[model samples]
Target: MKKVCKGLGTVLVLLVAIVVIRASGSAQLDAPKAPAPLSVQPSESAERLGKAISFRTISHQDLSQVDTGQLTGFHQFLRESFPLTYAKLTVEMVSEYGLVYRWQGSDATRSPILLIAHMDVVPVDPGTEKAWTHPPFAGEVADGFVWGRGTLDFKQGVMGIHEATEALLAEGFVPKRTVYIGLGFDEEVGGVLGAKRIAAHFAALGLKFDFVLDEGLAVTKGMMPGIDSPVALIGIAEKGYLSVELLVEQDGGHSSMPEKETAVGILAGAISRLETTQMAAAIDGPAREFFDTIAPYMPFGQRLALRNLWLLEKPLTWKLTQKPATNALIRTTTAPTMLEGSVKENVLASRARAVVNFRIRPGDTVQSVLEHVHAVVDDARVKVNPGEGAADPSPMSPSDCWQFDLIEQTIREIYPDAVVAPSLMLGMSDARHYAPVSEHLYRFAPMMFTDQDRGRVHGINERIATGEYAKVPHFYAQLIRNSSLD
Candidate 1:
């Protein structure tokens, strides 16, 4: 009996020891993974793309003129235009206008990839149609490009991607992994009903992607003064936003005999302090990674300056943050957007309120920003409240992996003369919604834009160059072809 009892005790101790070793092994295995490589081509069918651009599918803030009927026509147009894509791929609809298509691959073990673009364009201004050299919805093929609103903002992406898929299908080229195309209907107006609902659809199906590509940055010339080549900026992340309202209440009295500190006076003082004591600018996150990638492409002297960013980052950030455009890249920015006070012109009493909008940097939070505002406007009478406009900054994506390198190499193959660089997007996009689950989220619209073309994005005379328009579809095709599951 004694011998049996001793044997049982030894076996129990061994089992516990094995369990501890297995737990430790699992913890260590969860290290960060490197991004995958992408394979891309540069040739596209431009003639077909021009025809696809002719459709007049526009999105408006007012739901009345949205024209769901036009959207249906546009969908039909896609089917008739790209017969190969419609026949081969599986399509799903998230809502009335939102579309998602999946191109299956040979291997199912590898995670799927998503390419996203919105199909809707903002409504033309009340009388800006005449300002356009070609009508906003004309989709004319003049001056070697397509002239239209959606041509620049997004229709280009939609048409280009579909055209690429169609061409690839013709060549019988198959992807090693599954590729998904997610199209939103209302991106210009926050994409709440469109992209937000689409995200929920993916979540319900337990579909997690390796990466998602969307529109944000583009290739630009003279972006960097010394660099001669056009730089292709791939957005790794975007800033957060919030609107804070400061209010001060005072007893009603005659304007002729007001108190020493009137309600308006108190509000003005708070605004001044908040503007003067802006958030501290820091060099970190995706913004710093952006400079690091382009450093090698820069002149030796400039490269030296960028390579030693750790030491020079603080001073460089402080100086850049002083300018309006450069300032947006470094820290949270504040702008006094709206102000409200008394009801009548003669009355100068009661309550005064001012609305300040803020675009927050990556590391900061809404709570931390609010605390800073309170500290800056150190007045007992002034009360700060969260305004309607507020959104936390999107999470930053990693750039060190093969996913970013693939984007750089693909752009190089097509526009051999252009330089590729990472960037921090100043504005928000539907891309933000996918960042939480995706390892790599890139924002790039593979189209060429000149100085004048840049202004047309949300302004008048929007159009894309003819030669460049033809290459847009080819860029998408190359990106899809270059990507492999291995």
Candidate 2:
């Protein structure tokens, strides 16, 4: 009887092992498959895009330096370049720099789609002209590249969308749903006058869009290792900006005679403490979704690492959020940007202040971040204050919805080799303004760029490949046609 009982126990253990093995195998099999490749048709009207890049509508940090006449020239260039688009669409100027064009569709009951891009480019630093392969604003076409400043940062979107719309109009194709194109003039300085005004205009008109697509992410090769395809990041949300000032005050005296802890010393110590006790990192929101979507494309080790994210989230977050680029992905980051103290070298007088800039992550509030800093510094002598009109992190859009799936499908059609992944944009854009009103707001510029091309954006020798110039517009056209209200 004892031997029979032992035999039954061994059989039960083997059965349990088999069940676990099958469950593991099933989970592996359920992993997502790589999306289908994108098929692109090269644009015949690529020359017009080269001409569009010639305008020098650069936005300066100092508003007074902006050349209004140059912007006017750009407006004229748009009018002359795409005659079909101008003739077919109804264009309206919102503010001095904001341009919005509305194309009437066959079905008005279906929700409209808004395509956004900025017309302005950031000012090139003084005395960097020598580095360019061609002149920055010369808009030279050489070696199958369109060399200019706005070629990548934006104007590519401007021209690409226009070119696509024009091409569709030429082909006598009418969209099933209403299509709106918004071009902001002051994106570099902040879209307050441009995109903000446009959003206000739409709000006042009681207009709501189904989805709005703007410039944010791009398709990149080798961005995700172990994934053979290029990772095309789609910005589902953006980080918030907050400038915190830490002020410390103490008794002043001559340099020869100083207190044990001076104002400057106290401020520096507080800054150091805050830096060492950095914000806690935990993967959540769009960033977590991003990794999950691409996990199947990764190697077996990386797949396992990503699959168990929920279980291993604490350690993974700590490891990934230490670096600037990766940290920007998970939690809010604080950087001590500016310092102010006594004017004279010899006089160690009263007060010292440090301005620390924070890029707040989603799910993080300005109040919460400030509280964390206060706890870390633990200095009663120091006072922490908020900066000018700091915006909180924008709300995240849904990844499981059809809106995102449509975007991923469009990208796959445009760049078949690229894998669509969600990402959190560290910098701000006009897309943030629309988040409150629109259900689905995405940030992505469908232009193919290599590492060198990416660097050129807002840098010296900015340029876009001619091949990309042609492909991007077609991608926009495809997206417009493919997207349905349902």
Candidate 3:
């Protein structure tokens, strides 16, 4: 009995020693930087962003609600706002409102770099206009922020690209490789009319870019667990979103004389099953890369778990699942967004419909999700069909490449103390549409976000700080210079 106790204690100490040794070997993530921030006058740029927000280029689910006049006028606004950019770059409109500009570089041998952003913004909720500190479309630049709908959902990205190009043009600095800017007008509604068409247009012309950058992740603070410094998340890939509608049809009867299973009850059961039995979560591909990249910055205990995921994957995964944000990094998320059954409360719901949205992890597909749904629900009464915006997850971009290094270096230039890491984008972006155009697709916007600030996107009081707005142009200019000069 004494020998058994001694053997167990010896094994435990050896395990602890192994964890310590592995964690101690982790190299600190300190990227060297020598570049400085590029120029964008904060107040002036904030005012410019505010004015752009006032255009009312909102995307609606109903096509008739979209005002073409406002979109056309936005093109004119860009013409007036940046005179030098208009004069220097060759501008071509694709799919009516999608604008494509090409800045001719000295060496056409080098493949061009593409920077993209959407011009359209999601509309404010019906009654929430009065709730805003400033009116949603007022384009108010006050209180250290440019307050409006597009401030965060991304008119800033559109303006940032132009501001950088105009500055570079003014300084007589020419790109060694051709630079292309794509401004899609309908990104808020799945980017079908905008980025998809523009990407096809690029393909038809046999233009394969070196890399394409779009807005997704940002410089986030207090978002990462067990890390103190601000981390710049560069999205190497994005999750595909799928919407599946569950339908049930049953015989109608009086509320007092209900059938054993009404349509509403059937749909409710299907939804419950989906919510409870989520897609299997595993650390693979981009998620693995994310954990590995940020492992060095974690506290010793967390560092041990991260560095030794081979032995501790299940326990660490369980720990990560405790947080909603971290749980999303590992699996396909199921969300029941819409449901319709009966108009009156006392009436039996003979026919019911519900929509379940899934943000697919890299290894899963639309077909696979449907299969899982059918297998799990295992009910003949529930009808399942694909809904809007079904797409497969994008292929992972190479993390160890010159394009990635340039992005890291440029991030360090502006955010010297920040840790740069490759991350998976939880939300869909227009960047995914350009996958056919470039294998090297990255999604990152150079704005700072905190835990309290993330809800502002497509939510009330949407705004970006004047100081943060200034960094966007500098980040782009530096990225352009670094990529082009290579």
Q: What is the TM-score of each predicted model, taking all chains together?
A: 0.84, 0.88, 0.96
How does candidate 2 score on lDDT? 0.81
Off by over 4 Å in 3: 1-13, 25-31, 34-39
Model 1 regions more than 4 Å off? 1-65, 249-257, 341-351
lDDT of 2 by residue, 1-486 (tens): 999999999999986555444324212222243432233244445556566667778887566788888888889889987899899899988988789999998987888889999989887788988888888888778888788788888988998898788878878878889999999998887788889889989988888888999999888776566776678899999888889999988888798898888999999999999888888776888778887877767776666667676556777777787676777888788899999998899889598999999889898888888889889989799999888858888888877788888888888877776778888888889898776558888999887656666578789888877777777876788888777434
Clashes by residue pair, model 3: none
Residue 294 of candidate 1: its Cα lDDT? 68
- Candidate 3 TM-score versus the reference: 0.96
lDDT of 1 by residue, 1-486 (tens): 899989998888886555443223110111222322222222234445455556666777666778888788888888987898899999888877899899998888988888999988888888777888888776777766667778788888988888788878888888988899999988887787778788778877888887889999988877675577688889998888888989999886778888898999999999999999999887778778777766666665556556666546677787778778678888899999999988887788599999999998898888889999999998989999997647788877877788887777677777777777788888888898776457688899887666666678877877777667666676777777667724
lDDT by residue for model 3 (1-486), tens: 999999999999999888788888545656665654555577877888899999999987666889988999889989998999999899999998899999998997899999999999988899988889999888998888899998988999999998898888888888999999999988888888899999999999999999999999999988887788899999999998899989998887779989877899889999999989989888887889888988888888888889998889999888877778878988988999999999898899888999899999999988899899999888999999898679989888988998888888889888877888998999888998998899999999999999777889999999999889898999999888887664
| Candidate with the larger TM-score of 1 and 3 | 3
lDDT of 2 at 287: 79
Which sequence of candidate numbers ranks them by TM-score, best first? 3, 2, 1
RMSD of each: 12.9, 4.6, 1.9
How does candidate 1 fare on TM-score?
A: 0.84
Scanning candidate 1 in windows of ten residues, the lowest lDDT window is 25-34
Worst 10 residues of 3 by lDDT: 29-38
What's the true lDDT of residue 150 in model 1?
84
Q: How far in Å is the alpha carbon of 162 misplaced in model 2?
A: 0.6
